[model samples]
Target chain A: MSVLLVLLIVFGIGIVGFFIGRQRASARETGEVKVHSRAYYHGWWVFLVSVLPAVLFIVLWSAGSSIYLERSAQASLPAQTAESAVASRGLALSMVRGIATGLDRLDAQELQNLPQSYADLRSLLGSKGVALASEGQDYMVPIAERWHSQAATARTIGAGLAIALAVAGVIFGLSGIHPRARARNNVERIVLWGLLAASTIAILTTVGIIFSMLFQTINFFSVVSPWNFFFGTVWDPRFADAGSGGSQGQFGLIPLLAGTLYIAFVAMLFAVPVGLFAAIYMAEYATPKVRATVKPLLEILAGIPTIVYGFFALVTVGPFLRDLSAAISGGGGFIMAQSVLTAGLVMGIMLIPFVSSLSDDIITAVPRAMRDGSLGLGATRSETIKRVILPAALPGIVGALLLTASRAIGETMIVVLAAGVAARLTVNPFEAMTTITVKIVNQLTGDLEFNSPQTLVAFALGITLFFLTLAMNIFALYIVRKYREQYE
Target chain B: MNLMTERSLEKAVGDKMNAVASTNKMKGDKVSVFYGAKQALFDVDLDIPEKMVTALIGPSGCGKSTFLRSLNRMNDTIEGCRVTGQITLDGEDIYDPKIDVVELRARVGMVFQKPNPFPKSIYENVAYGPRIHGLAKSRHELDEIVESSLRRASLFEEVKDRLHDAGTGLSGGQQQRLCIARAIAVSPEVILMDEPCSALDPIATAKVEELIDELRQNYTIVIVTHSMQQAARVSQKTAMFHLGNLVEVGETEMMFTTPKEKRTQDYITGRFG
Candidate 1:
């Protein structure tokens, strides 16, 4: 039977169960004593009992049987063909299944017109407007035929077993519909498990990602020494991509790590003071009319996409800085359009609304009583802000800054467009450099051998970047929580 | 408590206060206030006596707190609030352009209903006021000022050992007293308290009442309280207000015992607010 028809029948049985259980529960209240549970609860109880077991059986049966059928199809082939087909079993099985479906589409007259031999089956099917990749390789015929028969048998059994289980569940549910039956309690427990499953999926995916990175990082470390990767200064990885038996290149992390920190530091130097002052003016000094007009205008900077910011940096800010540097240095400047200074300044623009808006919210959250106490003591407004307000909001402000720092470190688009991929170790902000993220992107873009150190190194860099951000987020959350406890 | 009926009784008390106007520390002449378009106070004429605790008692939203806040220009912080009147401190018109409000606030301090201690060491919390006003010559003088202020607020003994601890760590009553100490550290002449004991227990309230009695020896105090018994205990003079009108003003004993206005009688005897 078709899947849609089966679904309709299963739901029809659930409706029958619902009515049976509700009527049985109502019948127990013999015109004087009342039923303990509501009629809706009894109906839902019967519906769930009738549908869940049958659905679970169908899902598990389909998943388990498919794998078993694939293996048997492969095993039915001769030894040489099976050996050659092992690496491409999934692809091979999909094509064979497609051919079987095409044959199932034939009518009685069409089947009689086709030749009986396996050799002519391709042209015969082709005449019926079906195509195969390689006209069904020599050993695929027996496997395809067997798969066709096995699939039909599995479908028949799955339908029969699902309907029977649903019927049994319905009978059991109607028998248990007494006044004292705990349908609500059972439903609540199921809901709790459903919520638990939803939250656990996120945590489980994070763990799975970490383990996958850990395995690949271990592989990379086996080939590249930890000492060379951590401490060495030079960064020429072109030799590693020259195929096997070539001299391995230096895998030092210091230069990329330095570029990342330097750009982030410069970005912070620009963002922190500017954002903080803007927050103070908005929170403490601006009139309500002015604040209402200005705050959302400032937040519009946050709503802009970072890719657009990258485009602006690449086309606009970088050239402006380059021309300004030449003018300042009198034509002897070393500044390029794609220097760290260019990237850092533009990245700082992207980060302004982040720092200002978060700090503004944190500052405004400080109690009004603190301000009143200070002002009442004859302190000037500036004095009150500097002494009382900032100190009160310091811990939360620190947490906000650290979170911005993580975002800066993880930032890719601005660095990719504005900062050149030179990977040089230098202190001058006017010089070009590359970050860990930019390097990761550079190594992973093209198709190549997967097992080579060149491709695998992205995973190693990825895990390093991941741990750095994870540590920051944890510390930021800790400080924020501690600050909340003090005031609350 | 009809306005027409209370006006006759208000005149009897007005004739009595007219004889004692010379001893007043602060005077409000025909003070009318508007917050946005709503009139919160009518023409309120009052005399705050020197070196004594005067309590302003009224039901909520009767403009008692509003009247108290206007004395120190604290209401100036609220936007869209306008006051049209002459309020003089020591015979100088405080609203005059030549008079600096910052200096005026230094001479008049306020305490809020809730205890708000700066998230700092107890020593810093008290020293904050004196440091801002440049009242202390050295760190040692500042320490002495902090000690004396805390002693005056009666919190020095409990917090002497933990001077470096955050002021927020204190109990509710102690924190209120700490705020008092912070205010007193500036050595202001007039102290305004808006229901300062409302958030405290009975014992703490009594302790604060005793401290208020002691403070009256040095500074002129104006207290706004909801508890009528509190107004009777802590104040030498009592002012009764009903629906934005000052019904009567007299000695606390006389005001509570033989109030001139029937409205004041109704409010004090729990007939209706």
Candidate 2:
């Protein structure tokens, strides 16, 4: 009567139906009458027909039955308990379900000699390894008994219906197999639908994430004004206790936005020239043997997890810069150990592979004819690349740089570790600063009430960061598309 | 027997207007070319006459293009390609270590089979060579060089109004002429063309052919052509190749009429390629 057992039975029916359908289709292949599809196509078609509906029914039934049992158990609660706050009601229902499972373990004699009080019942369930919460009440005993019986009955009826559907599917599927059944087409259609469903699931999940963040952001805005949150330069979100009349404090976006853009700009400054030179060398100058070995090594730099890069920045590069500055300045270093410079340098290293890989592909895509034309005109290789190849590939390279910029902006771990969390709006690269992603992590980590502005602010930060990256990606795609049309 | 007599009669008529022999501008001595492990061109000797259009005619993959590319050392760009014999420009070994390839290419320019104008403005495309070589001292001089180069390529009058338009925006034949202008801007003594009219329509082909005839007065031109008729029409001297070997070399009229080799006869008369 369990879901697993029902699934196994459905699979068995499908296997049987497969053989029967294939045999029938093969028998129809006489001299005058031909089977339209291969025998295995008919077999697979029948197997899908017999299995799909039954599996769907089992999944739907289990979900529906659990909801029905919870509702019935809640209704059976005592009037005082039933009329409690929604949170307490939910707590009571969970206790009921747990007691129901514990009751199933009791023998027949123990069931007949049931406890009459909550304390005694708790002791009996405790002996059965089902530790009920201290909030358990006497009325839960009867409800648990009724809940257990209803679940059992629901499972029995679900198993019967699923088996009956599988049998009917087998009969109907085998009946369709004849001299001219287009089983191959039907099977292919089913596969197409399966692929579409997979893609739809991914799209739906993205939409769901957006909507969930949007609603919570709306909740956060109700507590804090949009104008103050957006335009205020300060970003001191004072964490207030629930139900206390304390200042909500500033939730300014400017410092974090500046930090994000400034760090990304610094990373681009370091990465663009180096990465572009590497790309050009690989595309135009490197021999085939060198290129074959070097490109993958560059990509392997991209494969290193961002968290490892964060550790490197925190432990190695930040201190090295601080010491180097101290040595040169002959005093306490102007650069902070955990500063925007540290994070930007490390993040630039992380972004180098991204820029180089995309740019290498873009630069190589410049037609060989372009190089020949320039070289034939007596231009040196560097001169040819400077005037002809680079100009043709400029749009694509810009698109790649924009994509890398978005990645640098959204980077979290490195900023959190290397760039200190104090959200300062300083222009100096030596000072510690924070970005939106780092702030989002900061706001959400500690123990707090979900509805508090402190917690809700995380959702607001998340949506803002999402939109910023989204805009950059859209612009990048636009440039890439415009570049593509130039060649074709 | 009748075809032989007819060829003999045509040869007698061609002998009346025999071409005057000219000094050799570029000479290939026992030239051989290889791509990786594959030998593309066998040892061959051919001379390109100064200020004359010498056409190389052959079937596809018969090393005609290979020999043409070798004339400008363009094969050096291809990976694993090797040229074993000496190619000299006015008795100077082009492949010598002392010679700068950039300088040699400046003096001996090339045009590809397909029109490959730089993705730049037409004026920029023409000025690119002159600017790189420092042929002009000032902007005015650069402008004058561009105008004269385009004029020599026969593209000046047509593209005079839109000198700043993208060179790639021009039609195929115009693009090829722009490439020719780009080559001529450097004022190379020798120009190599690799099937320059293969990508053009008949009208464009005629225009390029006419331009080639005019260009022969100042520049030594070596052209590789698949069309026997194109070779006969544009070239003063013609060399026939088959299977990576030179079959015959003589006046274009005599080579087309009374070919010395049977393979040359078969290729030109459409017996088999």
Task: Name the top lDDT candidate.
Answer: 2
Docking outcome class, model 2? medium
Candidate 1 C-alpha lDDT tens digits along A1-488: 65556666777898899988887777776756555677667877887888888888888888887888888876665556446633466666677777677776677676556455545777777777988665356566556766766877898888888888888888888878878788777767877887999999999999999999999888988988878888878777774454765677777889999999899888889989989999999999999999899889999998888788889989998998888888998985667899899889988988888899999999999998888888888888899999999999988899999999998999998999988899899988998999999989888887766777777788888898999989999999999888762653
What DockQ do the predictions score, one after another? 0.58, 0.63
> Can you tell me which runs of candidate 1 are displaced by over 4 Å?
A1-58, A82-136, A156-186, A483-485, B1-22, B95-99
lDDT of 1 by residue, B1-273 (tens): 222224324532552454355277899898877899998888889988888788999888898989898898888888899888889999999888898878888899999899889999999999999999999999999999999999999999999999999998998899999999988999998999999999999999989988998898788899999988788777778888777778788876677767888888888877887
Candidate 2, residue A470: the lDDT equals: 93
lDDT of 2 at A437: 90
Candidate 1, lDDT over the whole model? 0.84
Query: Chain B in candidate 2 has what TM-score?
Result: 0.93
- Tell me which residue pairs clash in candidate 1: none
State each candidate's chain A TM-score. 0.85, 0.93
Q: Cα lDDT of all candidates, in order? A: 0.84, 0.89
Clashing pairs in 2: none
Best by TM-score: 2
Scanning candidate 2 chain A in windows of ten residues, the lowest lDDT window is A479-488
